[model samples]
Structure formats: C-alpha cells, structure tokens
Target: MRDKLTTIGFDADDTLWHNERFFQLTQAYFAELLADHADHDHLMERLLAAEKRNIQHYGYGIKGFTLSMIETAIEVTEDRVPARVIRQLVEAGQEMLAHPIELLPHAREAIEAVAETHKVLLITKGDLIDQERKLAQSGLGELFDGVEIVSEKTAATYAEIFDQYGDGPDASMMIGNSMRSDVVAPIEAGCWGVHVPHGLVWEVEQAEVPTSNPRFRELKDLGDLSALIDQIS
Candidate 1:
C-alpha cells in the first residue's frame, strides 16, 4: 500500500487556508449595499442566481463574484444601482485579491508530513492571477512538487493531473473541502478522496457525500492527516 500510493493532491482555498469566510464577509457587505432594494435573503438568492448565470462567461474567483454582485444590484434596482455602489464592489474584490494568506489549522504540518514520503501537488480552480497571488502569499509554494490551477474540477481533470504528477489517478489521493470537486470527482476518476470540512462553503460547491464508496474519507481537520496516511500505508 505504501508503494502503491505515490501522490497526494491538496486543494488550495478553504481546505488549506481561510477563503470562503472572506467571500461571506464581502457578501454581507454586498447585502448591506443594496439593503434598500431587496431584503437579505432575496438579495443573496439573486446574487447566487447571477453567479450561476455568470460563471460560464466570467469563470470563478473574486472578479467574477464582484461582477455578479454588480449585475444583481442592477437587477434588483431595476438598473438604477448607483455608480458609487459598483465602485465599492470593485474595491471589495481588490481587497480580497490583495488579502494576506491565513493557513488553516494543521495545514502546513500536514503538507510537510505528507510531502516527506509522497509527492504533493496543489490543485485549485480560480482566476489565474488571483490564484497565483494567493499561492505566492501562502508561503507554502516552495513545498509543492507541482501546482495545477485548473479551470474546473472534473473526473478527467483529476485523471490528467494525477497522471502528470505521479503514477495515475488510481494511485493518488485528493484532499479538500468540496464534496463535489475534491471527493466525488476524484473518486470517480479512481483516486482516493479525503474531505476536510471547512464549515463555510459556497452553494455551487455543495454535493452529497459518497458514504458507500470505500475510498472516501472524512477528517475532522488536517491535524490527523499524517496519521491517516500512515494507517493507509
């Protein structure tokens, strides 16, 4: 088993560092900005709708989210959204882009421990520049054998990445907070999936847990990841 598992894939955002909370905070402010036009619930719903509609055109990350906020505001205000509000939205995204990286509990330790014996790769999806900025700021960049800033997480994506980095998807494991991308898709591609819950999650990333699958695992935090790998090996 030790020799069989040669590669480990880690998700960047919420799994290894503080990410979704910043988005949540910005969203709260977004709700406040358009408080006059719509209630909190309705505004969030509309913003989510805008995000869903805009994802294909804009892709994921702060810029896409900011644009969606602007679009939602325009819709709710019947195209009367103030220019000041749009300016603020853009500024909010700018702050998120420049924000310092904060590592999640045990993130670095887990990476260091795992990387000693297994190849470690960072697999994430977002705006290329913003993703690169965060990776640079994270200070963990030097540890990874490789980095893959993908456009999306799918079975084929995982298969290709694992094959490029190590033996193949069947000989690799993916650890992340999203059940859809981190667990289901990787497992579908014949890799092991480890889910480390981050509490705060984006709606689009949500998916049902694959409890029936033998390769699926749920960790309380990254603190125990090394022990789990040891057990598996």
Candidate 2:
C-alpha cells in the first residue's frame, strides 16, 4: 500500500483536534436553557433532527449547530422561545466561533512523519473561516502539501482532491474519525480509508464499518498511523 500511495488526506475536526466535545458542551448548555420548555431527552432528540434537516441549508459548523438549537427551542416552546434564550444561543455560537483549537494526541507527530515521505493533505469539510482559523492555530499548515477545506466529503470530493494533489484516488489514502466521511467515502473513491476512533463523535458522522472492504482499516489513535503505513508498505 505504501508504494501505491502518494497522497494522504486527514480530516480536520476530531481527527486533528478537539471538536465534538465543544459541540456537546454547547448542546448541554442549550438543554439547560430550554429546561423550562422541554425535557432534556426530548430537547436533544429534536435538536439532532433539526441539525440533520438543516445541513442542506446551513452546511456544517457552529453556525448550523446554533441555528438548529434555536429552531429546536422555538419548536419545543410552541414558537414562544424567549428572546433572552435566543440571544444566549447567539452568544454561545459566537463563543464557539472564537474558541481555541486544541490538538489531539500525536496529531503533529503523525502528520510530520507522513509528510516526510508522502503528499500529506489536510482535507476537511466545514465553514471556511472556522476551518482556516483552526488550521492556523494548529501550526501544522506548512507541513501539508496542500489543504482542502471543502463543503462536503464524498467519493467525488476525494477523487478530485487526490487527483489534483497526488497520483489520484488509487494512489491516495484518507485518515479521520468518521466512518461516513473519511473511511467509507475515500474507499469508494478507490483510496485507502483509515479509521482512527475518537472519544466523542457526532451521531451524523457515524456509519456501519465497511468490514467487507479490503481497503478499510482501523487504528486506536493517530500515534499508530505512521506504523500502519510502514507495515502496509
């Protein structure tokens, strides 16, 4: 696999840094705010539904999550969600936007190791400004051969990026925490898809493992990524 691979794509959120935890924290605050209007479990259910519905409209990131929280509040409160609550949600979102980036374990080491021999790419899908901010804060921007902040992660997206940045999908690989976006989609594009499980993953990002796929792989953490590449090579 090493001889066949020329490019490696890494997911931004969760895979490289702390992401879903912040969203979960914000959501807990949201649940507290709506405690009077809706039960905790019910509120969470509605919010997840709203997020799934709004992805097409808002895309992904803090903005969409904030909007979904507001929508869920309004719906649960029979359209009587308080103005204060709305303001608080907006402030919460602003805080999220300004939040600091925290790198995950071995993120830097893994990227540095692979960049030494392969065309390493930071390929992720999210709001442009936020993703750039995180990357800047990460201080690993210069290590990547390229960075692709896309609107979505699909087979087509992987194919286009790999072709542009490396030898193409058959000679590429993608690394991330999400089964749906990182592992499955890239594998579908003829790239190796490596899944490195994270402590907290967004529900929408979860997918059934493609156990039947020869290119599908799982690692406990990014620390083992370099070794996996070497072994496969």
Scored against the true structure, residue 112 in model 2 reaches a CA lDDT of: 93
- On the 0 to 100 scale, the lDDT of residue 53 in model 1 is 95
Task: Judge candidate 2 at residue 5 and give its lDDT.
Answer: 74
TM-score of 2: 0.97
TM-score, per-candidate, Cα-based: 0.98, 0.97
lDDT agreement of model 1 with the native: 0.94
Q: What is the per-residue lDDT of model 1 for residues 130-151, given as tens digits with 9 covering 90 to 100?
A: 9999999989999999999998
lDDT (10s digit) by residue, model 2, range 1-233:
24377788999899999999999999999999999988999899999999999999999999999999999989999999889999999999999999999999999999999988888999989899999999999898999989999889999999999999899999888999999999999999999999999878899988899999989999999999998888666
Clashes of each: 0, 0
> Cα lDDT of all candidates, in order?
0.94, 0.92
Instruction: List candidate 1 segments past 4 Å from native.
Output: 1-3
